[model samples]
Target chain A: MSTADNPIAVLVELRDGAVARPTLEALTLARSLGTPVAVWLGTEPDADAVAQLGEFGAAEVRVAAIGAEARYPAKAGAAIAAATEDASLLLVVSTFLNKEIVTRLAVTTGAGVVVDAAGVEFVDGEVEAFQTVFAATWNVRTRIAGKAIVGVRPNTTTASAAEAPGAASIVPISVQLPATRETVTAVEPVAQIEGVPLAEAPVVVSGGRGTGGDYALVTELAELLGGAVGASRDATDEGWISHEHMVGQTGTTVTPALYVACGISGAVHHRGGMQASGTIVAINMDPDAPIFEICDFGVVGSLFDVLPQAIEAVKAHRGA
Target chain B: MRILVTVKFTPDLQSQRSFTDGTVTRTADDGSMNELDENAVEAALQLVEAAGEGEVYALTVGGADAVAAVRKALQLGANHAIHVNDDAVAGSDVFGTAAVLAAAIRKVHDENPLDLVITGMAALDGLTSMLPTALAAELDWSQLTLASSLEVGDGNATIVRHLPDAHETVTAPLPAVVSVTDELNKPRYPNFKLIMAARKAEVMQWSLADLGVDAASVGAGASRTTVVDASPRPPRAHQQIVTDTGNGGNALAAFLIEKGLA
Candidate 1:
């Protein structure tokens, strides 16, 4: 197939059997590149998901029926490769699992892969991806020569419905998965956070050493803003919060629309993970906290004092 | 049991990092064994210590400065150290680097079978987190990545992988590749005796030809991507700071309200 006609495959991730917010954003991104072909890795998606994908400009929904084994990267990567044989580029939500799958896919297909991309575009008929590196201090533009797999971070692209939406045709695919030694013995699903997933949350409120092991105010503010609660390495290391909620270079990297750092020192490691946030707001007792340098708005005060008043003001605003 | 742990030398995270000619500028003065690799070395040492009769080989593929990675692993109590340094290996992407690592691993495996290969979750400089998966693909081995906790016995390795959504327990047979997260274990500081011994240890060095990998197929020429442009991101503009007497929360809320971020 010619490059012009080659489809842009968007790997659709599902949460609760529905299209994930990041996948929708990816579909929206794929539509601009070419014909958006939604690639579903597991069992067939219900009609609602198909319709949702279609609304997001997926011209076709290709379901790779790989069953339970699809959770494995080798199996899932093979299925995706089989499904996107004619695709010029593949776009995925840049989670750790998806990065592995795409990396394996790139190895198998000899395609270039770039993950944690802030944006990707076609320049001079070649794919160029924009990403932040070195603790989000540098912006690099990478050009992929041929077939490419770009893992885009959550909240990077706006999820929008197509202007001219239509019914998407579903194409079922069967893949012959290769033999691998890895086996998933068991999966324990963690209890879901009350609101959005941390990575995909539009608003994130993170606490650090100043929380004093008390996440009560942090959780309250996060709930009030419909955001996700996050912790610094200090808090996680102190066993104040689970490691999954830790945001840093070694932990989860979040790109939310609004990132609120409370009493966090904003070490470079922490900054590397969250510096790309759209608008940063920091509340800390220390005026010299590094977070204030990057934050669009900063409040120098104890979070204990600031958060409660902020919470009440937010409530009042919502009520008004 | 035998294990091979891959380590990398990377620029210190605190250093002023920048890219030159589309690649990260490297210097021996500012580079050290990647911070995360300490966890990999620790995991390997613990696994071997538990096995009671096993060896751990620390391997690194890079330029001259990269040998420091394996040396650090040796200081951490690795029984053996191997450094693959070749000019052609410079500027290699993850795929190219994986090819070299896998070839070196195969050479070691041929000498004596390896039970597992362990690596850090990701390199701090690149932070791609793709090398372990790429190495597994290149070696045609099972890949168990992002392990927060791990256990090995009965010819199989089981790992507890903590993800944002779920906690998954994955198992893979021996001869697999596993990448561990920092949550796995606290790395032990090198004792004075081991540190002194590591300083005098002879590191086995090899070239691409020695590993039987063609230099042509694993360098910038073979790379599928090129960095067209790079620059330091300009700082955030119009920053505002407020000292909260009592209305700090009101100001915070008002700021969010004005920005439509609330």
Candidate 2:
């Protein structure tokens, strides 16, 4: 199939009846490759969804329209397969749910999946996916022989408004259903400290073992800056914080605009998760902490002593 | 009841890892069973021990070094081990790996129907977390992934998924695949007796032909994806260090203010 006939498809994910920020970035990335087609799963998007898709340059919006049966993996796979039959490429935000769909799609389509890709480009008529693997230590270029399905890392690109929005026409597509194998019976929201989503937070304030199991200073600083709170594996393992807040190779990988690491020793495991941050600042009492080596600015001091003053300074700056 | 647990032998995470020509530079003797898979082995062992009437089979696919993974599983108390070793299976991606595993599971089910298939959340090397779902799709079975807690009874499996923002309880009928996270259970250490037994126990080996998989459709040539290029990551840039005397915090805050990050 010619590339022109098969447009690049972006799997659109909606939350609270609007396009999620990551989905917008995925749309932006899809438009870079070729004509962008947004694939809406489960329900027909409302007018607002269509406007947002067009703002990101979606020329067409294909709705799979599966009813709410919680057939997350199976239905998602069938929908993506039906939508991207002749598409040049398919893009999805790499979340736990979408990763499963990507795998299933690979099996059903005899295709290959590149997970957690930072970027995608068409090189010499073949799609190349740039992946940062092994704790962000290596940048590998991967290629798929057939139409490629890629799971892009969130926040890899900033979403930009298009000058000439595409005329998006919603087209309903039929899919061959796979047998329902799993269903989400119940969901309980996590009790959060309440700030921006950690993955999308502009600033992240993290504490580690050097905090002496005291997160009071870290939380105060984070809240003062209107940022998210993060913890190291040691802090989480020691019960100082929940696993959900841990930032490391085995935990959540974050790339915020500013990452302020307090009391963290800069272990390789932790570095693997946050090395991609736009700017790094380290605060550690130990002058020889490894984190200082990678920080854009480093402070050799106790977090307990430094955080309070930093919070006050930030407050004063804002007030002034 | 019959159970199958899947394990992968990957390079130790602490070891200096690299890729050669787009493939992992797997060092011999440095590779062992993936740490997360140990949880699956432990979970399987506990389930079989509790029931007292079921057998757990450990399965893995790779070259010669992969036998070490099965041996580790056997040491952890799996009744038998099956190693799918074929030269043609080298460089197979997740889909290819899942295809082989599904075929092997089906071959075993034909002999004695399986009640459950379990795996870890992901392989540390690839970190794709794709095998269980792909296997489910291939076998047309239910998949319950990232379960922090699990229970099996009355022809059904129930799991509690510890998601980032929420906790979800999911249930699926038996003859399903489940992937467990590290928080599920603490893995037990192999006793000396089991260690000795693992060395003496015979490991069954199967080839692509034995599993009825076409080599061309799975191995390097059949691989849907290729590594076009790879290189070592460049070193991080030099950093600016600040010694916090009394004004350190204010200085750091001033920097954030300058960058509009405060």
Taking all chains together, each candidate's TM-score versus the true structure is 0.97, 0.92
Q: What is the interface RMSD of candidate 1, in Å?
A: 1.5
Local accuracy of candidate 1 as per-residue lDDT tens digits, A1-320: 22325589999998877889999999888988888998998777999999999999988888887777878887899999988999979999988889888887888889999899999999988999999999888999999989999999999999999999988888888789988788788878888766788889998999999999999999999888889999999999999998778898888899999999998999988998899999999999999998998999999999999999999988899899
Model 2, span B1-262: residue lDDT tens = 6899999989877787899866887765898998889999988888988898889999999989889999999998889999999999898888788889999999999999999999999888888888889888888888888889999999899999876657989898989899998889999998888899999999999999999899988877777889998877776666678888888898899889987888
Model 1, runs deviating above 4 Å: A1-4, A317-320
Alpha carbon deviation, residue B100, candidate 1 (Å): 0.4
Lowest-sum lDDT 10-residue window in model 2 chain A: A1-10
Q: For every candidate, how close is chain A to the native chain A in TM-score?
A: 0.96, 0.89
**lDDT by residue for model 1 (B1-262), tens:** 7999999999988888988888888778988899999999999999888878899999998889988888899999999999999999877889999999999999999999999999999999999999999999999887889999989989888999987667899898888899999989999999999999999999999999999999999888888888999999999999999999889999999999999877
TM-score of 1: 0.97
lDDT of 2 by residue, A69-170 (tens): 424777788878888887868999887778888887777777778888899999889888998888767889999887788988878888986779866888
Alpha-carbon runs more than 4 Å astray in model 2: A1-6, A189-193, A223-226, A266-269, A286-294, A315-320, B241-247, B254-262
Model 2 steric clash total: 0
